[model samples]
Every structure is written in C-alpha cells, then in structure tokens.
Target: MCDDGLMTSPTHRAIALLSLFSVAQCWSGAALADRLGVSPRTIRRDVNRLRDMGFPIEAEQGPEGGYRLRTGGDHYLAVLDDAQSVSVAVALLQAAAGAPVTSTADSLRAIETLRHLLPSSVLSSVKSVHAASGTVDVGWNVPPDTRLIAELAAACNRKVRVRFRYCDSRGRVSSRDVEPLRILTTGNAWYCVSFDLNRQALRSFRLDRITELTVTTFRAERRDLPDPVRYLQQNLTETPRWPVWARVRYLAPLEMIVGEVPRLYGSCRSAEDGTTEVTAGAEDWDALAGHLALIAIKLGVTMQPISPPEFSDALVRIGRRITSFGAP
Candidate 1:
C-alpha cells in the first residue's frame, strides 16, 4: 500500500545486485529484473547505483555479453595484508582439518576465494606459511567421508538450509530440517550447529553419525544464531560416549599447543620440567591412543584403560590393542 518506490525499493535492488556479485558465477540485469519482477529500467538504475558503490559489473554490447562479474568486483577482500591472509588460511585449516569429514571444507572454499581476492604480495605471504610451517598436526578425529562433510559445511556457511538424517542417543533415526550455521570440533567429535525448524530451537548434530544430508530451500534468520563452539560446551552430548581417561606430557612447554589443542576435561598443568601434562577422557581408549601415536611427541600420551592406575602398563596394553601388530 505504502510507496517503497520513493524510499527503499531502489536501494534494496542495488544492494541485491551487490549481493549477487558477492556470491555467484554470473548475473544480468535483464535476468535479474525477471527474477525480481521489475522492469529492465529499474534494474539499470540499480546497476548504475551498484557501480557507484564500487561493484565492477561488466555490461557488454552486441549480443552474448549481457552482463558479467569482473575479477576484482569485491572490494572487501582486496584490503587484507600478507600476514592477515596467512592467518585466515590457518583459521580455515583449523576449522576443516579436525572435523572428521572434510568437515572444514566450507572454510577452505572461503579461504581459496579470499586468497584469489588478495593482492599478489599478500597471497605470497599466505603461501609462505605453508612452506615454513612446522610439525603442527594434533591428529584430530574427522569424518571418514569427506565429500558429504564438505557438502554439509558449504550448506551451513551459505545458510543454504538443509535436511539430514540424524540418529538420536538411543540410536533411533529421524529426518531433521536445519539451518546449519557452523561446523565445530571438540576433542574427538565434529558437530553441526543449526536452527531446527521442527524443534524450533538451536541444536548441535554430530557430523560423524549424519548418514545422509541434502541442501534445502528453507533459509535461516542468519543474525540471531548462537556461536557454534559456545553451543557445543553448553549442549555436551548426553550419550557419555568416551570411557577411558588418559594423561600425557607435552614435549615442549605446555603453552605451545595449549591454545591450539586444548584438554577435554581438567587443566593441562605445567611441570617444573617446562612441559605440560594434560588429562583427557575418551570412550574408545584404543582410538584415543592412535591419535596420540600420530603426534609422535615424546611422553605425549599414556592411556589408562582401567581407572586409578597412573602407571604405564595399562597404557602399554591399550597401545598394543590399538596397534595390534606390536609385540606383547
């Protein structure tokens, strides 16, 4: 009833064009008008406004080149420094690296998009980190099927709306419609944070148990969702899956890996020897032991298969069980 024409309609259209460039492969004003149910004249007005706002929209003549996105159309990513680029790359690596199924894939795609957007010098700096990077793997548990994880993560990051089969604590399966917000890893599990359309609440679904997933059309209210990591600590799964508790000392001062790989339970205490000892609980002792073995850091882990034994014999048994091929 009211006239948006004099106020917001044109402004909204212009912002929408910029948003299109921020995401897709290509966009044309004529096609855009068809999508928005407006005239090509209004689309032209909006396009010019977007050009004023610094969107490098390419409008070609004759016939084929109706409209296209130029390479540097996004001005936001062009300003990052070399160090910032590497830092972002590290964050992307951290996000997807530990999530069992190529879980951090969305972040990786964003990382690539960012890398391509950066200046050459900044990109070189980002690449330099890979070359100078030291041994930093914490051997986090990730999903075995990376393809599915990647697809789910992409859906969540783009707020693409999704549906997936979820197994409840009792092992019963149900289909859930979710607006996946983030992919998070804690200790050994990968979690998907989303707003549940059915439950009308925010829920964390375990990614490993997610057998099937598909993108949906139900978009989420992107602004109000909770942070994924905060949601994990609050919802800590009710199943109480892990049964073994392990303690280990870090090779370097505990401060080194503390920020990167934190203890699942108590404090990772520092010893007089400059190393830090960490305590953790896991349901599968052998699997936990395998994680420690890959770190290969000396004295880094001692599995306690049975509670109350601080000695190495029980841990040695667990290691043997996991390795299986090792001597008795």
Candidate 2:
C-alpha cells in the first residue's frame, strides 16, 4: 500500500482492461473517482466521454442512486499521451499485420497507445525491433475482460469501492467487497491485490473470472494502503510454486545467477558453511525443471523446505524428470 507508486504504464491492453470494469456499474461519481484514483472531476469526464461515445448511462434521481452504463457502445478505450499515439499506431499495425482478423484491432490499439505516450527518444530501438520482426505477426489473446479491468483500475486509483464475484484457487465463488490496491500480471494471469474487508485481510484476486466489476461507494470511500507489485510478488501466484523454491550453494559467486533468475531467495553467506546460499520461487513444480538443469553447472542445489509434503514431492519430481531427460 505504499502510495500506489508511479509504475510506468505497461501496454494499452493492460490499461484498457483496468479501466473497463466501471462501464455499467451503479455508483456515485465521487465514489467512482476514488476507485480510479483520480479526482471526482475525472470520473465525471469519463462518464461524459462514455455518454458521448453513445453508451446508455442512466443517471438516478437522488444522491443514493448513481450513474450506470446502459449498454452497446462502440467506444473501445483510449489512454494516450499524444507522442505515444503516433508511434503506437505504427507499431500496432506492424504487430497485427498477420493476426487473425479478430484480435488485430485490440492489439493495434495497445501499440498505438505506447507510441502516443512515449517521447521521441523513448524507444530508440523501435526501428530495430520492428525491422527484425519484418512481416512476423504475433497472435495474441486479448482478455475478454478488458473493459471491466480498465474500469476497475480507474476505481482502484480513485479509491472507490468495486463489487465483483471472485473465483479462488479451490474454485469456490463469492461476492467481494474490495478496496483494490494494485493490478499485477506476472504469470500469464492478471491479479488485483486488495483489502478484503469481509475477510479482513489483504488478498490477491484473479482478473479473468472477476465477473461484473461495478463501482460501489459503500466501502470505497475509506482509504486503503496497498502496494500492488510487492503484494502480488508476495501473493496472487498460481497455487504454490515449489519449483520456484531453490536452495543453491555456490562456490563461485551469487552474482552469476542474479540476472538469470528471480532473486526470491536473497544470497547470503552461509551461517556455518563458507558457501553462498540462494533461492527463488516460480509458478509450479514444472518450472523447477529449468532451475534444476542449472545445477549441472557444478553448483550444489536443493529445494527449500515448505511445510507441505506436496511441495517437497514437487521439487523431487522436478529433479527426477530433468535427470531422466539427461539434462546437461
């Protein structure tokens, strides 16, 4: 919850997704702004923009009732800085040049926004990447929940409450009253770190199944302290990443593998032994295969212990699998 620090904008796809959740929700403008981490005026402006784009936003009569989306608008989403738009447009066109006709538009928009937001010197190597990929077209899956994600981001930044149904790891479903902290997209999945007032704890919720994200004023007015990236790296990971857990004793040095892997386990001089110990956490047992292969480099390695038999089994299995493959 550290001040929702200024992390640079990722892709337009990410932004579009974060902002689209509030489209058809019933909530006050003030409350909406809080959820989006912007001034109330910005919420009004967003509402106006949606309305201008032909969305059917119904305004309620009294203060209790709030504005909501009606339906069927042609507008996608746009958050560009001008310099970014031009460059993005070109890059997107190039990226989507051969995609199936369906995802081309959304992919194109993401590139366009990047170009619009960046300064001229921002991507000195843009031409190089573009040239290398010449006619190479990247097929991508644009999440079906982009609009809702976009709106949710806006709501989170604005400190407004958001309502959505959550599907957890065990596949249990429940309605959530969340004060969104930050959005994390680490493992081919998107996560929202938030204060689950009901649970009275910080939790990471996935974005894919966060159905119907509508703005809520009931609890959003209260301030929440959340640092999304740290929270995500700490939580919201897929199941438990046992393969990600590594304990390696290196005679050479820790700096060698520092860039090669996530430094989940800080390197330290062993308490009794004179070797350096290092560890990392990944997504699953399957991921450990790669890390274990690095053990062939003459470094003594083992999986760090977690309190679960399954986690231990996972690591051993990974080792056996790589060894079976004659990993060198």
Candidate 3:
C-alpha cells in the first residue's frame, strides 16, 4: 500500500503515477518506488499494466532515464479520476450558462459528453450541484465577442496600449487610446478597466460598446491603482453623471444595512452612535428620497436625510402623497 491511504488501490495508484508523470519530465524507477513505497520490481509491473491500458508511457533504463508520458499525438487521452472529471463537468456547466471565453453551444456539448462518460453516482452529484446553485437572470446576459475579449486580455497581459472607438450612453462615438489594465465582469456585463491616455485618467469602458480596437505597439507605464472592482463601482455611483448626492442616517445598527445596501448604490459606514451612515448619489432629490424610503420600508426602520435639505423636502412630498392616497 502507498503511504497515502487514499491511493493504495492499483487503480488509484495508476492515476497518481500518471499525475506525477504529467507534471515532471522524467522519474527514475528507484525514485518512483521510493515515492510510492513499493519495490522497483512492483513499479515495473505497474508500468507494464498502464502500458497495456494504452497510455503512451515511455520508459528508459539508465542513471538519468526513468518514465515519462508522450504528448502532441492525435491519440491523446485525458487522465482524470471520477472526482476530477465531475469537477470539470461542473465547470463546463457554469461556462455554458454564460462565459465570455466559450460559446454556450460548445460548453453544453462538452457537458453532454461528460455526462455520458461519468458514472451514475458522479452524474447525480453534478445534477445536485446544478440544482442547488439555481440560476440568475442578469439583465444583460449577452457577453462581449469572445475574439474581442481575447484581444483585450492579451493587451492587458502584455502591458500595452490599445486604441478603440467607444460609444457612450448618449449614443456618441469617440476614439480613445488607453492602457488596458484589466478585464472585469459584473455577471451582467463585461468592462475593460483602463487608463485613458488622452483623458489622462482611469476609465472603465463597457466591452459591448467598444469597436475598431487595435493593439498598439506602445508600452504602457504602470500606475498605482485601487482595487479594480471598487474603482469601477465608484466610477459608476459617484461620478458627475449622477447629479444629486445625498447622505442618510439610518437608525438601525451598522450591520443591519451593510448587506442590504449594495455598494453600487452608495457607501455605508458605521456612525459614532452605532448607526449606519450611507452616502449615495442619484439622478435627483426625488429619486434619492424614494430610494431611501424603499430601503427604510425593507428594513422596517426609521431614517432621516442628512444633507441637501431638498432630500428632506422630497421625502415630505412623498409622505404627503401617500397620506392623500389613504384619504381617498
């Protein structure tokens, strides 16, 4: 038996031996015996057994010679145990749901092949995982073109600048030259977080809106950047595009609102008196006021507007309208 109790069986040992061979360039017979806690003769027998099973294992006999698997052949086989195969199947299922790197049809076909190859118990586990995870309908489920994403990703990795035409929310198109820093996905959409050379600032461009992309030969100078996701969220929630900024004092404990208010809406911090202070930006006073009312109603707690006195006035107007509706 092997030192590791799990791979004691011949089948398990063969899998483990193949795993080692795949990673290393070569392993001597004595070294293989020492690692598996078996004699050199037993290792010989195991090698013969794997060869009979049609694995392209090559053996050499000398001080430097040992065993290695062949590659780059038309008749290649993927070596995976039941558990690893099931894991790959689950990953394929997620990719099928929506992965920028793979088309849904390709992922689904791969998943179906895995299902046919997996054992009954393993298939059941895959089904359970899919059922438990459920599904989400992200508003914009369309991913960016896979080839376009590949180009942008390569630019980011190469630390190179790229030029592209971008369309903003108002349907205006403009050319931009930027240093591609990262490719990020919010599940609903994909974005390329970059440093705009022309604007001389960090910007997040929606991948769907990008066109005429060309990778430039210019190398980009690295700059200190905040966490990409946080920076993008800040750009979305705190930018001048959102005209009204409002602060609210929640009467509840900080923990109560921390999870309820998403970061894209605003930032939340604990106040001195054990309350949660949220600073959010919205289109207008009425919009912010209505947002606060919805949160307060959901949390079943009282809240007061803390800034831009107009927020308080808007809240009063909403309350009066609600009261008038009750009178009718």
* lDDT (CA) per prediction: 0.57, 0.50, 0.70
Tens-digit lDDT track of model 1 for 128-156: 43222211223345533434445565575
Ranking of candidates on TM-score, top first: 3, 2, 1
TM-score of each: 0.39, 0.43, 0.52
Worst 10 residues of 1 by lDDT: 129-138
Ranking by lDDT: 3, 1, 2
Worst 10 residues of 2 by lDDT: 1-10
- Candidate 2: stretches off by over 4 Å: 1-145, 169-172, 184-189, 217-219, 224-246, 263-274, 282-290, 295-328
Clashing pairs in 3: none
What does each candidate score in C-alpha RMSD? 17.2, 18.0, 12.5
Q: Could you say which candidate leads in TM-score?
A: 3
Give the Å error, residue 226, model 3: 6.6
Instruction: Tell me how far the alpha carbon of residue 87 in candidate 2 is from the true structure, in angstroms, after superposition.
Output: 14
